[model samples]
Target: MGLRMASGKLRQSFRIYEWLDSHKISVTSIAESIAITPSMVSHTIRGRKNNRRVLKKLVDLGCPQEFLSLPIDLEKQVAA
Candidate 1:
């Protein structure tokens, strides 16, 4: 079974992902800016991982605070 995520958080995650996409932000760039691995940033973006530092950096880069928080189930979203 896939991990479960709240509908609200799922939507928020998507919003954050979309915002990043529209702004041409890449996981590699985020990782470089925050001194973390690109995989960590990518996982965080996909809601498969949670890293406070990464989330903070994303907020610093203009992502809305409300749309960023905790981790969700990317697999479930994809399956749907």
Candidate 2:
């Protein structure tokens, strides 16, 4: 899983953003859920919500981790 993890940082960040963005979810709400500031998450993904805790929450919200962990354009998956 090293290869996957090695690529996880960017993938995870992007996946997190795409997931939340698509849902029309606000950064403040996401931040509240992850216990982090909206800026921290925003900074991570270029103004998109991107944090490990957020990803875990998204996963818990029914997003399959297998697909989430993959380094793909997550926008398509999470859009409406």
Candidate 3:
């Protein structure tokens, strides 16, 4: 068995995603920067792709790779 996330449920707990959303950064913006479509971002966010490529995107967005290891406190971040 593999790690399982709720299907089609956005893992919004990531601090970056949360912060962006908090600042009202549209999903299309994120998608544009990441070279993916808004719907693709929507799908990936919704946990439709449990692989969760957000980490890579974070790196592309200039977030330090070391921060990848930081505890995300998924529950709180997602609930925000």
lDDT of each: 0.69, 0.55, 0.52
Model 2, 3-33: lDDT tens digits are 3333354445566557677888776876788
TM-score of structure candidate 1: 0.65
Off by over 4 Å in 2: 1-5, 9-18, 43-51, 64-67, 70-80
Task: Estimate, for each residue in 1-80, the C-alpha lDDT of model 1 and write its tens digit.
Answer: 54345323443667887899999998889999989999988777766677667876786788875676533453233235
Per-residue lDDT over 5-72 for candidate 3, one digit per residue giving the tens place of the 0 to 100 score: 35334344365466556667667887787677787766555455533355456545654433343224
Give per-residue lDDT, candidate 2, residue 42.
64
Residue pairs in steric clash, candidate 2? none
Please give each candidate's TM-score: 0.65, 0.46, 0.44
How does model 3 fare in lDDT?
0.52
lDDT at 20, model 2: 70
Where does candidate 1 clash, by residue pair?
A: none
For candidate 2, give the lDDT of residue 43. 57
Q: Candidate 3: give its CA RMSD in angstroms.
A: 8.3
Model 3 regions more than 4 Å off: 1-19, 51-53, 58-80
